[model samples]
Each structure stands twice: as C-alpha cells, then as structure tokens.
Target: MNAPIRSDATPRLEDYPYRLSDNVRFADLDPNGHVNNAVYASYFETGRVTLMKDPSKGLVPDGLAWIMVRLDTHFRAELHWPGTIELGLGVVKFGRTSVTFDQVVFSQGRCVASAQAVTVLIDETTRKPVPLTDEVKANLKPWIRRGLDLYQRD
Candidate 1:
C-alpha cells in the first residue's frame, strides 16, 4: 500500500479521513481481464487496515481489534491493470459497540466500486464486544458523512 496521490483536480470525497493507494497486480485480474470480485474485498480490507494503523486517525487499540460483521459492495466499473487504485474510507455511523465504514475505489479518478461495512470492536482476551469510548467517538466524528448512514435505517 502507498500514500494517496493528491492533487487539486481530485474531487473531495464525502468526508474520508484516510486514503490509501494500491497498484493493481497482474495476479489480481481474473480470466475475464478485469479485477476479480474477491479482490475488491481485499482492497477494501487494505483500506481499513491503513486507516486503522494510522496512530493519529486510527482507533484499533493495542489489545483490542475491530471485526468485520457485514459488508455490502457494488461494482460499478471494471478495473484494469497497469493503474493505481485509490481507496477512500470514512465513518458512516458510530455505535456503542460497532462502527460502520463507507469506502470507494477509484482508478484514474473514476469510481470503480463502493462498499459499506459494519465492524465491531472486541476485547482480544474476552472475545466480546467492547463499548466505544467517548474519546474514540469524538475522534471519529469528523469523518462521519451526514447523509451516508447505511445499515442503520431505524
């Protein structure tokens, strides 16, 4: 993974605090010549990890971790090789014990895929859900996109 390529020409994504860059590998392509569907999931995972590892912006504690509970994805365009892909990650909703993420994959400034995931924090020792601290919630507030609240309609 690499740092995002930034430019004034790039449109500001909703409210992503984290952006990760990844080059499309030959092995990522399927027989159809486009990146495989499963590869998209891995890309999203990479985005999450990059976001979580940032000491200033990440919330994954030393002894605790977030686990993906669900993921909903939509493939809008086929991704080709010999290109760099940018992934944008933002917090859509913050819950007592879970956090929802909204992510998008872009290639050459074109939106390739979109995904939403719900992840819950758990104590590594107890393997049980842990409540989000106030500090963590406050830190994540700036990344929340007001109208993109998915997986929590009610």
Candidate 2:
C-alpha cells in the first residue's frame, strides 16, 4: 500500500482523534540508550488495540475479529527511558474488508515515531476476511484523522 503523503510540517498529537498515554520502560532501551526500535511497534499496537477493543467503541462486531495485515513504521527521534509517551491513532481509510490507521508516538511534545497499520475484519469461525458492516463503518467515522478528506483518497 502507498503510504500517506506527509507534508514537511510536523504532526500535532491533537490531529489524531484517538489518544492515549504510556510510559517508556527501562526494558525498552537499547544499547544506545534509546528506546528499542522493535518496542515502538508495541506502543503503536497499544494505541490501536485500546481504541478497537473498547466496548464503547463498538468496532468489532459479534462473531468477528480484527487481524493486522500490514504495518509500516517510521522512526523519527530517539526516546529515553523514565518518561511518559503519548500515542495517537486515527482511521485513514476504510476498505471493503480492511481498515487503515495512521499512528504516532510522541515524547515531550516531539514525535518519536509514526506508522500506518492495516487490519482486516475476519470471521472468528472461518478466519476468512469479511466485508465491514455498516455499523462498523458508522462507528469508525468519528475516529477519522483530522484535516483529512477521507473521500478524496484512493
């Protein structure tokens, strides 16, 4: 999938509709004293999972489950331990059987990493991709990325 066209301008945390805070753990550090690159994926996952798994969100329908099909990450800055990080996620695209999300990790007001993840809805029994239901689409509308024209994108 083509990544979104990012402007030279920096991204603001508030641009994302869904936001959460997490701590940078000592175990997340690498030999260079920066957060391990692999750990950023977990932080991004926490943002997406927290939003989709919330009962109030109504994202996952009965008898259905979401599975990650793709994740593209961009590491922006070095992050140190003993600090709190902010995570943000916003729905960027809705396909017939998949949802694409734009995610970010911020520390001390600076963006540390960003990613795009694609997840497809699947039948719990068959484990096959399923088209998104109207209810699920409606529930996701409010979570779209701010300043984006959802209809204009491919």
Best by lDDT: 2
In candidate 2, how many Å is residue 20 off? 0.6
Q: lDDT (CA) for every model shown?
A: 0.77, 0.90
Taking the candidates one at a time, how many backbone clashes does each contain?
A: 0, 0
Error at 136, model 1, angstroms: 1.3
Question: Candidate 1 lDDT (Cα, whole model)?
Answer: 0.77
- Candidate 1 C-alpha lDDT tens digits along 1-154: 1122222223345456678789999999999999999999999999987777679875777788888999888888899997899888877667779888878889988878888888998999999999987777777766665444443443
lDDT of 2 at 130: 98
Model 1, C-alpha of 73: deviation from truth (Å)? 0.6
Error of 1 at 138 (Å): 1.8
The reply for model 1, stretches above 4 Å from the true place, is 1-15, 146-154
- TM for every model, in the order presented, reads 0.82, 0.93
User: In model 2, which range of ten residues has the least summed lDDT?
Assistant: 1-10
**Top TM-score prediction, candidate number:** 2
lDDT of 1 at 99: 83
lDDT of 1 at 126: 93
